[model samples]
Target chain A: MKLQHYIGGIEGLEPSSFEKKVFVQPWEERIFGIHVAMMGLSSHLEAVKSVPTKFNSFWTWGHLRQGAEGMNPFDYFKYRYYEKWLGGISGFFVESGYVTEEELSTKTEAYLVNLEAPLPSGGEPAIDAQIIEYLRVGDTPACDVEAQPKFKVGDTVTVRNPPPVDHCKLPGYLRTKKGVVDQVYEGTYNYYFPTGDGVGDPMPIYNVVFDSHDIWENITEPNTKIYVQIFEGYLEDPE
Target chain B: MTENVDRETYSAARVRALESLLIEKGIITGETVDKVIDFFEKDMGPFNGARIVAKAWVDPEFKERLLADTPSAIAELSFPRGMAGAEGENMAAVANTPEVHNLIVCTMCSCYPWPVLGLPPYWFKDPTFRARAIREPRKVLKEFGLDIDESKEVKVWDTSAQIRWFVLPERPDGTEGWTEEQLAAIVTPESMQGAAKVAVPA
Candidate 1:
């Protein structure tokens, strides 16, 4: 099992920081913007109206999370949040043949010498506009399918134990546990792409609530309830 | 926090290089990164969430609609566009009452309500927070200086699916007659995340 997947209920780790800032490092903001821009310009985004940009690859949060989830468990915890983003995203550009490692490293060396070295300028303003447009008019995954929900509100369902994949939406701790459906969401939702386990197609998502004692037993706090939005694919009739 | 000094410089340079190369190759513009950052500051941020919560506090009808259908209720507001944008297509708000407190966490990756909340804070993204908060939310909240009495039920909402969840922190006392702007000013991001409570200035 990937340590990344089973982060919930793991013991002994202390709270890192109450650091309130969204971007801890100034450089983190740049990488975050780049990721968003990539998502906006992603070739697979059906809702976007398209822009004149050469970023032809299919990129999304699924692709980025797969990179981070694929890292060594120790390495995953060693790096800061955006630090992982920098490594994963830069690697994507390289692996996709958008840029070469040699070129990136050489530019790195040049910038190290002069941190304020001016970035090479000039590209279409349409590219930036499209990226912002994606932010404004998001590509929602809600589909036109009539609800064919298997479980209704108050149904006690067990989370299916699908074979673990690199990235999964099922919180590892919730697997095999029984939860009561608190709310059957209004309509169907679709993942951007199918995560090998069971998610990705148009299906109902449920707000399932579990007693903390049910999942963690005596170790959990008293009078605690955990509510999670889970895909219908990852849930089943309790065995 | 003894991070490698050269590694920090390397990362800074590396990201700059990535941006520069992307611009050079016509993948994104030189203005792309800056404009994206500006969007968060101007269009989407904690400021928007504060406003939503503030309006909810004053208008029980709007608050009722918000708790029932998050996107539809939020759409009624006059905030900048994109209330239902990226990471916010399906949103929900769980209200904090004296008996039940709500905390939002993504145990796997930091899944957050970006349009309403702008971005996940550094604390929310930390692995330790993710790991511990799911199982021991009361303890985690206590560490953050909010001693949630054992009598109060703590509901930790994990945003693992399409739905992005945020807390509708109870309006603080002595602010009954205040305007929406005054109420919004007291609502901090942490409070909206259920880590703390909105307090009137001491």
Candidate 2:
């Protein structure tokens, strides 16, 4: 059976009426804060080539998502977003050789042994405030190459239905679906794959307009339109 | 409840382990982590978005520029110099009008305008919101307490790392003479996300 596009389907699940909140628990806040810190460190490590693992931003993100994918459905749904991040980063650290599996497992055991012990503190800072500021302000340069866009605005093109194993920008739901190109972003941008070998080829991005009815079966609102950004390589002439 | 506590403990311990390893490896230090957290908490957030929306509401020219070129117009204001960097690059602003309601989502992942809107709320990143927002946006908006007219069109922008999107919600009425500060006060992060409407003070 095709996966239901709407999360709870039409009749079975009731929409949540509970008050929407930013963070449900204190640990969530820590997760969010630490995720930021991890991202900053990852970027710094990538910059300095300090770690043996030479992954880019997208690779790190893909590894994080893959980690969540490994979890059981119950735990996956129950764990907060930052928890998923923690899991992903832990798995990534192990896979990248930055931290050993024994280290991760043993450290948790040590912490559990003395739960009341004061948290580890006091270390020479690697990224100073100025470095953090510079990193925060840094921008990735758009790919500068001369290339003709295969599809123009209003061209009907379908997303290639390739099962990409590594990091990719194309979403699963959009695969093999046809949409009209709404806007063409001329410049090619460098996107890294999960394989830390090197930066992948750059490609221009486009905004494709897909009708809600075309994408989903039970169309509640036919007038609704979903605009998704598609990379040039992902598009193909519709069969 | 025990399971929840165990998971949190495990997660926290993992972070601690990772931090220690990075520090030991000379990759990063605890102070670096604290500094990064401080930057997000103290330096950047939705306040910048509120300021931009308020400025647009008061200045017609700026509003036109914002809708036309978001990054340049945003740079016009006294926001940080890195407005075009990180999650802020290729930023696009879609205004909500009487005929069209704009909603932002990333069906693939949570791609939000971090520089302007700050960290996204948990629900914004939830799988339910990501899927249903495209399938049944009107129903989703209603859940957020926004009931749109049947005559209006709903446009959902599936944002990505390539182009980050934020909604320019229609300014609430009855605040014609209000200062930018007052207008900014009324704008919530949800309003900018188009999940909830901006309301006038009673």
Candidate 3:
């Protein structure tokens, strides 16, 4: 599908002081088309995870993206080629009901404000402000309030080897690096719905530092150091 | 004691009164105002570090020091103090190349290297660009109307609120013997982000 169709929905929102026109080129159009398609797939994934049906196309698409090694014709059809079309269908399912702008705004505001609300113990609470915002408008989660870190200044620990496959907050560049805990900063408990994980306060992640040479690999000077700070999810118990 | 109490109460009351007046006057627009105030409250508001990046690009020793010890490099500049809304001794800057340009996007949220590159542009904050930029950076750059030579590498930095990065563009051409001031003239925020390159216009 063409990229213009993705942003076609945003045209209706009353332009506010914050609104401005952003043009797209062909390459960008394709990228956005992919992104919007992903959003639709992610929403469907949530739906399928919560309530399974022969309408399990979202899970099938996610599995294909994961490249889950298994027998799968339906997976390829739902995710590999027709994902965007299906995603657009997912978008329609979401925007089906009548919801007022004020209600939407109120919901959006709540999501943005309490972005890091924690997950309930044992039970995954399906409904959240961020989810509501994501379903109604394609807005993703932003700065969270509850990401409080646990490691202390000067704690020598190693980053976790590989992040959890399903969902993660860690970036790939920082995986498996070692460093001193420079400082402990607070993080909020905002749930990133796409991956379906919760970031919160009580167990805030510290910014662990790794030397520059270790991170970049190409540094010629052994003494040449590039320090990188990482969150807790990226770290594991240093052996 | 009574006078002191009265003064305190009066100041508090005055602040509340002004807040109400602003809201009544539409001077304070809902959560947007709260966000602005919150931003100010958090020391790492956008523009603070940008000034430092602008200054460092000119100073060779500062650049050296920044590369050496980023926090200390930033401390060399005054604005490094009180960096709110982030973790660690937060200081980082990424250099751009002639062949490839760099731009930052907070796909998940507006996670920026505030100390180096100040506040994000309106477009940077837009969900449209933010979401698509990560999934397809080259495509996004093409949309910005940049036609990078295929041979030239295009590296896109996705700062996922885990760590912040700043892009330092290749110094503009025709600067064979130009001073830092002249060099800095073309090193705009856009140039640093790789969306645009630094070229001394003829």
Candidate 4:
């Protein structure tokens, strides 16, 4: 399927194609609210595990996408974005052994037991608002590891159209496209996989300027430029 | 909005079930959820962005520092600790000038400057906004009720994990000699996202 570009006034693309409404159903708001809660919960869980020191949305997103894949195609498309998060968290809990398939199937028993128990103290919870806020704001993955930038500002490069990998920051639309490095951030940046088993090596990040004509086949205004953040691994010396 | 409705099949039910299970397991408590919600609702949000923008408008040196080094400049002001986390890390500020108007979008995913702008709006995360913002920013801006001049160039910045971006909207003409508080009153979350211009009070 051709991914819809946010570009305005392109030929053959209608404004109606945009799903402009913020939310179509009331359930969507509930899903969003719960998703925010889950984010805090998941980060706390990840911290308690202490294997991965950082919170990675890509990790959660991978699981979320995988869970959606299990659903019927129609349901997958029909469900709102946060609904996918809700389902994905369910699947993740099971997969990570936080809960069991039988437990999920028999939700009532677990629900009743928890409801009956006296509420725990705020201090007892594995993660609190302060930690959540810290996780939200601290420890950017940019590292001080010594590394030379492969490309410099103004260098012409092409996005490496490598075969699809399990997880990536590189957008599919920009693959094999040419752009100029508008700005170069001089530091090795580490991007951890959501799975937390491994991380992409620290590398310089660049702001690459791709002309509108290059991004879209049809050019309305050639002067328009799109600035995208790209990692060194995603760029190749254009042949 | 009906408070009591049958919603067993809704995702919220599933979330409740999950929350209960976590509580039962002694992993988290009801307070944990409340704290997270309260932080976003009360402490951290676009209000912070408004304050920063107001400061920049009144203080020229701070504005230069904000545009040059956003995080450090932000630290100069007393916001609650934790400005350098996942959402706020590597933040860069783009100024909206008469010559240029900036629009921020994340085509890959919803990567936003949460410390200043708080969470992204629902439409900001939509696939349509991500895909079209780069291609047709002018039209998208117009849809948001912002009509940029035809002569001015619109620069669309696609934010990501590496760098988060927020816009410093131009101060309205009538706000001269106004206190920072008065200037801040006019800043809106949409203006920080470059979706709408800062409202000029009558």
Candidate 5:
């Protein structure tokens, strides 16, 4: 039970702030942009072929989340949101041999000395074009195959409490809870890779509605209901 | 000499270094990160979502379509080239009404509708918010200064899988004859997330 997976319904947390800024610090904007570039140019996309580039590793939200999931549970909470992104992403570049630890450290030290230092300019226009094109078309998870949904609207189902893995789309609170299928989504969706706990193959997903009391009993607010879109692999017919 | 550099300064320098390195290598251009940021600033953001909500407020048929099918309804409007791009590939909308209200959250990580709502606000990504929203949305909303009467149904949409959801906030009264542009001005990103209501300026 990774503490990260069970964020929902965690007991004794402080009232959260309603900070509306997308990036609290200007630096967060840079890391976010870099992550988007990585996703757009990842080797998995056909769009990557349009640009002549040396970056040829499959990267996606799944990979990024996997990195966060792999962190020490305490460290996961210790870092601010984009701080984690900066760490995971830079680590990825080094591990992938796209850049070296020593080189990055040297550059970082240089920037520390003179924050106004300009960056090296120029690369293929096709690189930016490909990244922008990705933003336009997007890498949709919807596969062409028909979903053959097993459950239908109003069918009662139980969320499978699968064994723990590094990462999961399943909310920990929803595991072992029962709910009714509200909608069998239009088509089969595939994850970037198999999650090992059952989801990842192209399969039908469902919108399941759980009554608030059913999930948290009497501790929840009145007239409250929770709706979660769950992958089929994380759900069962409730034996 | 620099053992105690503040968190922001260290992170800022480190990311600049990484971006600099990626550009030096053939991985990405010097222009790549800037272009990516520009896309969000100009083309994609809460401004687009405001327009959609405003239009839905005036056009009954369009509102029905938006509630019935989100992506298709959004395509009807002339905005950026990527209304269905990035994290918004499969966007869904749940409208708030006098009888019911909706809140969107991602308990695992923040999976948001980027093309429409842009990047999620800082609070939306906070773990405390994610943890409490599913368990006690009404309480969470109260903390955010939104109060829901017990008579109303509070629907918390947890974006746990393929679908990324956002709220279609109800239009506030007292502006019946307003233009869509005027209505859009009052529609806030916080309102669209169900954390607060769209208020008429006093």
Candidate 6:
């Protein structure tokens, strides 16, 4: 689908003059004052700037500094938008929507600090950190070549019931699915990385088969099937 | 697609602006003038990939190579290539045989093989295609006038992610010993996606 469709019709908080006043302060000054005082002072000014235009333009800057110090500057900057806005004296950026505090802290520490952020939010940070670190060290050797396919064609397995998380490749439509292994395609490559960027190294992968009923759950035809060849990165050990 | 506007000056100006940006960014080096001249002179696109498929139809060995490693095989034709030196994903060339034909679809998003195939069709990018392709590939093919016999197996490949797929359609008969050029004329983009079959002019 067009990238435009994905970002379609989603408007966020309009930048007020107060935000402009807050943003105009020198970058260093804001950081310094915020770090020390933990107070935001600019909240009343209003301005009309196309948020999407600013978001797109800001992304280019982040891309320019790609992989710098093992940092995904884009996500870091995105979360920082939330942090600075929320932590800003004018108002909190977290009021916008969808972006969580845990996501903000996780990406910040992973990319900005360059150390494994102790994931207090359990698997979310760990997974985020892993993806980022994997992207940083592009084209690395397979970590678990032996943890390879234990199931072969004709083997029946149930797709693990995993909780929904934001910004995941696993489409909400398909979760906790069960399907037969139609064909065990080998040497497939998984592209998932810590940075959540498509720009990363490819890793070993596999393909699984799902009967149409399993995927859609209410399909009229029981025989129909959808064979999806995903990289090993997306799958878990058969339960 | 015919030009709707007669504003030649406006059209030329936009092209010039884009060319200037490309040149300033060092995207193309050496004789840049020749590249611009060539861009208009020749249709540089996935049609070249269509031509390769046409050639493979007449040559068995080429067909074998195409199925094995489509990236290297099509690179021989020198289509407008991409920066990814190595094949980034599963760039497979599945041929449509007389008995079994291959169709391409992306249920999630339009994940195309841009290196081999140029810009995708408008429908491929349409939400209708993304939503319907997986659920009703046969019905969609029928709408495209591709009626598959029940005896023949039709495989609709769902390339919703990174792996890019392109179909190598079965060469239509009646053009016996037809030259690659002649066969290529019959190869349409729809044929490559298994939505339509190549046919000789009646």
Fraction of true contacts kept, per model?
0.91, 0.40, 0.03, 0.33, 0.89, 0.00
lDDT of 5 by residue, A64-123 (tens): 999999999999999999999999999999998989999999888899888889988999
lDDT of each: 0.89, 0.69, 0.43, 0.67, 0.91, 0.45
Residue B13 displacement (Å), model 5:
0.8
lDDT for each residue of candidate 4 in A1-239, tens digit (9 for 90 to 100): 11222122224433423333434554355344434545444443435354222223334333443454455545644655666666777677677776786776556344443434343343353445534744465546688797878888899989876653444567666777899999988677886443222236787888998877787767434346677888777888445
Tens digits of per-residue lDDT, candidate 2, A1-239, equal: 11222222233334633235556554455445545544544553345344322223333344555465555656766756677777776676688787799887777677655544444555544345434644466445367776677888989998776544434456666777889999998687766342222224676788999887777766557578888887777777444
lDDT of 1 by residue, B86-181 (tens): 888878898999899999999888888888888899999999999999888988888999999999889999888888899999898899799999
**DockQ for each of the predicted structures, in order?**
0.70, 0.48, 0.04, 0.39, 0.86, 0.04
TM-scores for the candidates:
0.97, 0.86, 0.42, 0.82, 0.98, 0.55
Pick by TM-score: 1 or 4, better one: 1
The segments of candidate 1 whose C-alpha lies over 4 angstroms from its true place after superposition are A47-50, A237-239, B1-5
What TM-score does model 3 achieve against the real structure?
0.42
**RMSD to truth, every model:** 2.0, 3.9, 18.3, 5.2, 1.0, 17.4
Query: Per-prediction TM-score of chain B?
Result: 0.96, 0.94, 0.64, 0.92, 0.97, 0.73
For model 2 chain A, the run of ten residues with the poorest summed lDDT = A1-10
What TM value does chain A in model 5 reach?
0.97
**Per-residue lDDT over B100-187 for candidate 6, one digit per residue giving the tens place of the 0 to 100 score:** 7667766543456544454356556444554554545555566666777646665666663445678888777688888888888878
Please state the CAPRI-style docking class of candidate 3: incorrect
Clashes in model 5: which pairs? none
lDDT of candidate 6 over A58-78, digit per residue (tens): 111112122121223243334
Which rank order by lDDT, best down to worst? 5, 1, 2, 4, 6, 3
Instruction: Give TM-scores of chain A for all candidates.
Output: 0.96, 0.73, 0.37, 0.67, 0.97, 0.34
